[model samples]
Target: MAAIATDTHPYGRVSRLFHWGMAALFAWQFVTVGARVLLPDGALDDFLWPTHKPLGALLMLLVVLRLVWALVDRTRRPPSLNLAAHLGHLALYALMVAVPLVALMRQYGSGRAFSPFGIPLMSGFEGEIEWMTAIGGIFHGLLGWVLLALVVGHVGMAILHRRLSDENVLARMAPHAGQSR
Candidate 1:
Protein backbone atom coordinates (compact mmCIF):
# COMPACT_ATOMS: atom_id res chain seq x y z
CA MET A 1 0.00 0.00 0.00
CA ALA A 2 1.14 3.55 -0.69
CA ALA A 3 1.82 5.84 2.25
CA ILE A 4 -0.91 8.42 2.70
CA ALA A 5 -0.01 12.06 2.40
CA THR A 6 -0.86 14.26 5.41
CA ASP A 7 -3.18 16.24 3.21
CA THR A 8 -5.41 13.18 2.77
CA HIS A 9 -4.69 11.28 5.96
CA PRO A 10 -5.50 12.08 9.59
CA TYR A 11 -3.82 15.10 11.13
CA GLY A 12 -0.05 15.24 10.96
CA ARG A 13 2.00 15.08 14.13
CA VAL A 14 2.29 18.86 14.46
CA SER A 15 -1.44 19.38 14.11
CA ARG A 16 -2.21 16.62 16.59
CA LEU A 17 0.30 18.07 19.02
CA PHE A 18 -1.35 21.46 18.85
CA HIS A 19 -4.83 20.00 19.25
CA TRP A 20 -4.11 17.77 22.25
CA GLY A 21 -1.74 20.20 23.91
CA MET A 22 -4.27 23.00 23.80
CA ALA A 23 -6.98 20.63 24.99
CA ALA A 24 -4.94 19.80 28.09
CA LEU A 25 -4.26 23.46 28.82
CA PHE A 26 -7.91 24.33 28.37
CA ALA A 27 -8.85 21.58 30.80
CA TRP A 28 -6.59 23.17 33.38
CA GLN A 29 -8.03 26.61 32.69
CA PHE A 30 -11.52 25.31 33.27
CA VAL A 31 -10.50 23.65 36.50
CA THR A 32 -9.23 26.94 37.82
CA VAL A 33 -12.35 28.76 36.77
CA GLY A 34 -14.55 26.06 38.24
CA ALA A 35 -12.71 26.19 41.53
CA ARG A 36 -13.29 29.92 41.68
CA VAL A 37 -17.00 29.62 40.98
CA LEU A 38 -17.62 26.71 43.29
CA LEU A 39 -15.22 27.32 46.18
CA PRO A 40 -15.01 31.10 46.36
CA ASP A 41 -12.24 32.11 48.81
CA GLY A 42 -11.32 28.62 49.94
CA ALA A 43 -7.80 27.25 49.70
CA LEU A 44 -8.24 25.48 46.38
CA ASP A 45 -9.84 28.52 44.83
CA ASP A 46 -7.22 30.85 46.21
CA PHE A 47 -4.39 28.79 44.82
CA LEU A 48 -5.92 27.93 41.43
CA TRP A 49 -7.58 31.27 40.78
CA PRO A 50 -4.30 33.13 40.90
CA THR A 51 -2.97 30.90 38.16
CA HIS A 52 -5.91 31.76 35.91
CA LYS A 53 -4.62 35.08 34.64
CA PRO A 54 -1.14 33.84 33.83
CA LEU A 55 -2.49 30.71 32.23
CA GLY A 56 -4.94 32.79 30.23
CA ALA A 57 -2.05 34.83 28.94
CA LEU A 58 -0.22 31.67 27.97
CA LEU A 59 -3.30 30.28 26.27
CA MET A 60 -3.65 33.48 24.33
CA LEU A 61 -0.14 33.07 23.05
CA LEU A 62 -0.65 29.41 22.16
CA VAL A 63 -3.90 30.09 20.34
CA VAL A 64 -2.24 32.67 18.16
CA LEU A 65 0.54 30.27 17.25
CA ARG A 66 -1.99 27.53 16.61
CA LEU A 67 -4.02 29.78 14.34
CA VAL A 68 -0.99 30.55 12.26
CA TRP A 69 -0.04 26.90 12.11
CA ALA A 70 -3.53 25.95 11.03
CA LEU A 71 -3.47 28.47 8.22
CA VAL A 72 -0.08 27.27 7.07
CA ASP A 73 -1.27 23.66 7.21
CA ARG A 74 -4.70 24.37 5.77
CA THR A 75 -4.17 22.32 2.67
CA ARG A 76 -2.40 19.55 4.55
CA ARG A 77 -4.75 19.25 7.52
CA PRO A 78 -7.73 16.96 7.35
CA PRO A 79 -10.74 18.72 5.92
CA SER A 80 -13.76 19.64 8.04
CA LEU A 81 -16.44 17.00 7.57
CA ASN A 82 -19.33 19.45 7.37
CA LEU A 83 -20.42 23.04 7.57
CA ALA A 84 -21.16 22.78 11.28
CA ALA A 85 -17.66 21.50 11.95
CA HIS A 86 -16.18 24.40 10.00
CA LEU A 87 -18.29 27.02 11.78
CA GLY A 88 -17.82 25.48 15.21
CA HIS A 89 -14.06 25.65 14.82
CA LEU A 90 -14.33 29.30 13.78
CA ALA A 91 -16.41 30.18 16.85
CA LEU A 92 -13.90 28.47 19.11
CA TYR A 93 -11.10 30.51 17.58
CA ALA A 94 -13.07 33.76 17.92
CA LEU A 95 -13.85 33.24 21.59
CA MET A 96 -10.33 32.05 22.39
CA VAL A 97 -8.86 35.26 20.97
CA ALA A 98 -11.54 37.57 22.36
CA VAL A 99 -11.50 36.31 25.94
CA PRO A 100 -7.86 37.06 26.56
CA LEU A 101 -7.77 40.27 24.56
CA VAL A 102 -10.65 41.64 26.60
CA ALA A 103 -9.01 40.61 29.86
CA LEU A 104 -5.74 42.27 28.87
CA MET A 105 -7.63 45.43 27.97
CA ARG A 106 -9.29 45.42 31.37
CA GLN A 107 -5.99 44.75 33.08
CA TYR A 108 -4.36 47.68 31.30
CA GLY A 109 -7.31 49.97 31.91
CA SER A 110 -7.43 49.16 35.63
CA GLY A 111 -4.13 50.92 36.14
CA ARG A 112 -2.71 47.69 37.48
CA ALA A 113 0.58 46.30 36.31
CA PHE A 114 0.42 42.82 34.79
CA SER A 115 3.54 40.72 34.39
CA PRO A 116 2.67 37.21 33.38
CA PHE A 117 5.75 35.10 34.10
CA GLY A 118 7.35 38.39 35.18
CA ILE A 119 7.65 39.71 31.62
CA PRO A 120 6.17 43.12 32.54
CA LEU A 121 3.68 43.41 29.75
CA MET A 122 1.68 46.24 31.33
CA SER A 123 2.76 48.94 33.74
CA GLY A 124 0.54 50.43 36.43
CA PHE A 125 -0.89 53.90 36.04
CA GLU A 126 -3.19 56.25 37.93
CA GLY A 127 -6.98 56.00 37.57
CA GLU A 128 -8.93 53.37 35.67
CA ILE A 129 -10.46 53.70 32.24
CA GLU A 130 -14.10 52.99 33.01
CA TRP A 131 -15.07 51.88 29.54
CA MET A 132 -12.32 49.29 29.02
CA THR A 133 -12.69 47.82 32.49
CA ALA A 134 -16.45 47.76 31.99
CA ILE A 135 -16.09 45.92 28.73
CA GLY A 136 -13.93 43.24 30.27
CA GLY A 137 -16.06 42.97 33.39
CA ILE A 138 -19.19 42.45 31.36
CA PHE A 139 -17.91 40.17 28.64
CA HIS A 140 -14.88 38.20 29.83
CA GLY A 141 -16.45 35.64 32.13
CA LEU A 142 -19.67 35.50 30.10
CA LEU A 143 -17.91 34.73 26.86
CA GLY A 144 -15.63 32.28 28.62
CA TRP A 145 -18.64 30.28 29.73
CA VAL A 146 -19.99 30.49 26.21
CA LEU A 147 -16.72 29.14 24.93
CA LEU A 148 -16.94 26.29 27.41
CA ALA A 149 -20.39 25.47 26.11
CA LEU A 150 -19.16 25.46 22.55
CA VAL A 151 -16.27 23.22 23.50
CA VAL A 152 -18.69 20.76 25.03
CA GLY A 153 -20.75 20.85 21.90
CA HIS A 154 -17.65 20.37 19.80
CA VAL A 155 -16.62 17.28 21.73
CA GLY A 156 -20.10 15.88 21.61
CA MET A 157 -20.25 16.32 17.90
CA ALA A 158 -16.91 14.63 17.43
CA ILE A 159 -18.04 11.60 19.34
CA LEU A 160 -21.35 11.57 17.53
CA HIS A 161 -19.65 11.73 14.19
CA ARG A 162 -17.64 8.63 14.96
CA ARG A 163 -20.65 6.71 16.23
CA LEU A 164 -23.20 7.79 13.65
CA SER A 165 -21.21 8.25 10.51
CA ASP A 166 -18.26 6.77 8.65
CA GLU A 167 -15.94 9.53 9.82
CA ASN A 168 -13.74 9.06 12.84
CA VAL A 169 -13.37 12.75 13.50
CA LEU A 170 -11.72 12.42 16.89
CA ALA A 171 -8.95 10.28 15.49
CA ARG A 172 -7.94 13.08 13.19
CA MET A 173 -6.74 15.07 16.17
CA ALA A 174 -5.97 12.23 18.57
CA PRO A 175 -2.72 10.35 18.95
CA HIS A 176 -2.75 6.83 17.61
CA ALA A 177 0.56 5.28 16.86
CA GLY A 178 0.96 3.16 13.72
CA GLN A 179 -2.67 3.59 12.79
CA SER A 180 -3.50 3.77 9.10
CA ARG A 181 -5.23 6.83 7.73
Candidate 2:
Protein backbone atom coordinates (compact mmCIF):
# COMPACT_ATOMS: atom_id res chain seq x y z
CA MET A 1 0.00 0.00 0.00
CA ALA A 2 1.28 3.51 -0.94
CA ALA A 3 0.07 4.57 2.48
CA ILE A 4 2.78 2.45 4.02
CA ALA A 5 5.95 4.25 5.08
CA THR A 6 8.17 2.34 2.65
CA ASP A 7 8.49 -1.01 0.93
CA THR A 8 8.96 -3.28 3.95
CA HIS A 9 7.32 -1.27 6.75
CA PRO A 10 5.16 1.64 7.79
CA TYR A 11 2.48 2.34 10.36
CA GLY A 12 -1.08 1.82 9.13
CA ARG A 13 -3.36 4.82 8.73
CA VAL A 14 -5.54 3.74 11.61
CA SER A 15 -2.47 3.20 13.74
CA ARG A 16 -1.16 6.65 12.92
CA LEU A 17 -4.56 8.16 13.58
CA PHE A 18 -4.91 6.41 16.90
CA HIS A 19 -1.43 7.45 17.93
CA TRP A 20 -1.97 11.13 17.16
CA GLY A 21 -5.54 11.19 18.34
CA MET A 22 -4.46 9.57 21.57
CA ALA A 23 -1.89 12.27 21.94
CA ALA A 24 -4.69 14.81 22.00
CA LEU A 25 -6.57 12.63 24.44
CA PHE A 26 -3.52 12.28 26.62
CA ALA A 27 -3.18 16.03 26.58
CA TRP A 28 -6.70 16.19 27.90
CA GLN A 29 -5.62 13.75 30.59
CA PHE A 30 -2.96 16.15 31.75
CA VAL A 31 -5.30 19.10 31.64
CA THR A 32 -8.10 17.26 33.36
CA VAL A 33 -5.71 16.11 36.06
CA GLY A 34 -4.23 19.52 36.59
CA ALA A 35 -7.71 20.88 36.92
CA ARG A 36 -8.39 18.38 39.64
CA VAL A 37 -5.10 18.58 41.49
CA LEU A 38 -4.59 22.33 41.36
CA LEU A 39 -8.15 23.35 41.90
CA PRO A 40 -9.86 22.76 45.19
CA ASP A 41 -12.30 19.86 45.28
CA GLY A 42 -15.89 21.09 45.25
CA ALA A 43 -18.74 21.51 42.77
CA LEU A 44 -16.07 21.60 40.08
CA ASP A 45 -14.91 18.16 41.16
CA ASP A 46 -18.16 16.46 40.19
CA PHE A 47 -18.28 18.20 36.81
CA LEU A 48 -14.63 17.49 36.04
CA TRP A 49 -14.85 13.93 37.29
CA PRO A 50 -17.46 13.07 34.69
CA THR A 51 -15.36 14.65 31.99
CA HIS A 52 -12.20 12.96 33.18
CA LYS A 53 -13.86 9.58 33.46
CA PRO A 54 -15.01 9.58 29.86
CA LEU A 55 -11.70 10.89 28.59
CA GLY A 56 -9.96 8.11 30.48
CA ALA A 57 -12.29 5.52 29.02
CA LEU A 58 -11.60 6.92 25.57
CA LEU A 59 -7.92 6.48 26.28
CA MET A 60 -8.58 2.86 27.14
CA LEU A 61 -10.31 2.40 23.80
CA LEU A 62 -7.45 4.02 21.91
CA VAL A 63 -4.93 1.90 23.70
CA VAL A 64 -6.86 -1.20 22.76
CA LEU A 65 -6.92 0.03 19.17
CA ARG A 66 -3.18 0.63 19.21
CA LEU A 67 -2.56 -2.84 20.56
CA VAL A 68 -4.65 -4.34 17.80
CA TRP A 69 -2.92 -2.20 15.20
CA ALA A 70 0.49 -3.19 16.50
CA LEU A 71 -0.46 -6.81 16.19
CA VAL A 72 -1.63 -6.42 12.58
CA ASP A 73 0.36 -3.58 11.09
CA ARG A 74 4.02 -4.13 10.30
CA THR A 75 5.40 -0.83 11.46
CA ARG A 76 8.80 0.38 10.41
CA ARG A 77 11.31 -0.71 12.95
CA PRO A 78 13.77 1.80 14.29
CA PRO A 79 17.51 1.43 14.16
CA SER A 80 19.27 -0.86 16.58
CA LEU A 81 19.51 0.28 20.13
CA ASN A 82 20.84 -1.15 23.40
CA LEU A 83 18.88 -3.67 25.41
CA ALA A 84 17.87 -0.96 27.87
CA ALA A 85 16.31 1.19 25.18
CA HIS A 86 14.49 -1.76 23.68
CA LEU A 87 13.17 -2.73 27.07
CA GLY A 88 12.10 0.85 27.61
CA HIS A 89 9.90 0.70 24.54
CA LEU A 90 8.33 -2.45 25.82
CA ALA A 91 7.79 -0.81 29.17
CA LEU A 92 6.29 2.23 27.46
CA TYR A 93 3.73 0.11 25.65
CA ALA A 94 2.94 -1.80 28.81
CA LEU A 95 2.40 1.36 30.76
CA MET A 96 0.41 2.96 27.98
CA VAL A 97 -2.02 0.08 27.90
CA ALA A 98 -2.14 -0.67 31.57
CA VAL A 99 -2.41 2.89 32.81
CA PRO A 100 -5.72 3.60 31.14
CA LEU A 101 -7.04 0.15 31.82
CA VAL A 102 -6.18 0.24 35.48
CA ALA A 103 -7.92 3.56 35.80
CA LEU A 104 -11.00 2.31 33.99
CA MET A 105 -11.01 -0.92 35.92
CA ARG A 106 -10.84 0.97 39.17
CA GLN A 107 -13.88 2.91 38.17
CA TYR A 108 -15.86 -0.02 36.86
CA GLY A 109 -14.56 -2.51 39.34
CA SER A 110 -15.47 0.00 41.99
CA GLY A 111 -18.97 -0.03 40.54
CA ARG A 112 -20.10 1.53 37.27
CA ALA A 113 -21.50 -1.10 34.94
CA PHE A 114 -21.30 1.23 31.97
CA SER A 115 -18.65 3.58 30.73
CA PRO A 116 -19.13 7.06 32.05
CA PHE A 117 -19.32 8.09 28.38
CA GLY A 118 -22.67 6.25 28.14
CA ILE A 119 -21.46 3.23 26.17
CA PRO A 120 -21.96 0.29 28.47
CA LEU A 121 -18.95 -2.01 28.66
CA MET A 122 -21.30 -4.65 30.05
CA SER A 123 -18.39 -6.91 30.88
CA GLY A 124 -16.57 -5.54 33.90
CA PHE A 125 -15.72 -8.09 36.58
CA GLU A 126 -17.46 -5.98 39.11
CA GLY A 127 -17.90 -7.38 42.64
CA GLU A 128 -15.27 -9.95 41.88
CA ILE A 129 -12.91 -8.41 44.39
CA GLU A 130 -12.98 -5.31 46.56
CA TRP A 131 -9.21 -4.96 46.59
CA MET A 132 -9.23 -4.37 42.85
CA THR A 133 -10.48 -0.88 43.42
CA ALA A 134 -7.93 0.03 46.05
CA ILE A 135 -5.02 -1.36 44.11
CA GLY A 136 -6.22 -0.01 40.82
CA GLY A 137 -6.93 3.35 42.32
CA ILE A 138 -3.48 3.74 43.84
CA PHE A 139 -1.70 2.45 40.78
CA HIS A 140 -3.91 4.34 38.39
CA GLY A 141 -2.97 7.71 39.81
CA LEU A 142 0.59 6.77 40.61
CA LEU A 143 1.28 5.24 37.22
CA GLY A 144 -0.17 8.27 35.58
CA TRP A 145 2.91 10.16 36.73
CA VAL A 146 5.04 7.32 35.49
CA LEU A 147 3.23 7.31 32.16
CA LEU A 148 3.76 11.02 31.87
CA ALA A 149 7.46 10.62 32.50
CA LEU A 150 7.78 7.81 30.03
CA VAL A 151 5.92 9.85 27.41
CA VAL A 152 8.17 12.81 27.99
CA GLY A 153 11.20 10.61 27.58
CA HIS A 154 9.68 9.04 24.51
CA VAL A 155 9.04 12.43 22.92
CA GLY A 156 12.44 13.76 23.88
CA MET A 157 14.11 10.81 22.26
CA ALA A 158 12.02 11.15 19.13
CA ILE A 159 12.88 14.83 18.81
CA LEU A 160 16.52 14.20 19.48
CA HIS A 161 16.65 11.45 16.91
CA ARG A 162 14.70 13.41 14.33
CA ARG A 163 16.04 16.92 14.74
CA LEU A 164 19.49 16.46 16.19
CA SER A 165 20.47 13.21 14.51
CA ASP A 166 18.47 13.94 11.36
CA GLU A 167 16.85 10.55 11.39
CA ASN A 168 13.37 9.62 10.13
CA VAL A 169 12.40 8.32 13.52
CA LEU A 170 9.14 10.26 13.79
CA ALA A 171 8.08 10.26 10.15
CA ARG A 172 7.69 6.51 10.43
CA MET A 173 4.47 6.96 12.36
CA ALA A 174 3.47 10.42 11.22
CA PRO A 175 0.85 11.16 8.58
CA HIS A 176 1.71 10.54 4.97
CA ALA A 177 3.78 13.06 3.10
CA GLY A 178 1.85 16.19 1.94
CA GLN A 179 -0.88 15.64 4.49
CA SER A 180 0.47 17.20 7.65
CA ARG A 181 2.58 20.21 8.66
Tell me model 2's lDDT, rounded to 2 decimals. 0.69
Tens digits of per-residue lDDT, candidate 2, 40-106, equal 5766665665677778877777787787777676444433345866788788789888887787667
Model 1 lDDT vs. the true structure? 0.84
Q: Give stretches of model 1 more than 4 Å off.
A: 1-8, 175-181
**TM-score for each of the candidates:** 0.91, 0.76
lDDT of 1 by residue, 22-75 (tens): 888888899999999899999999889888999899999999999999989899
Q: What lDDT is reached at residue 105 by model 2? A: 66
Give residue 8's lDDT in candidate 2 (0 to 100).
27
Which pairs of residues have clashing backbones in candidate 1? none
Candidate whose TM-score is highest: 1
For model 2, name the residue pairs that clash: none
* Regions of candidate 2 where Cα sits further than 4 Å from its true position: 1-10, 42-47, 75-85, 122-128, 175-181
Clashes of 1: 0
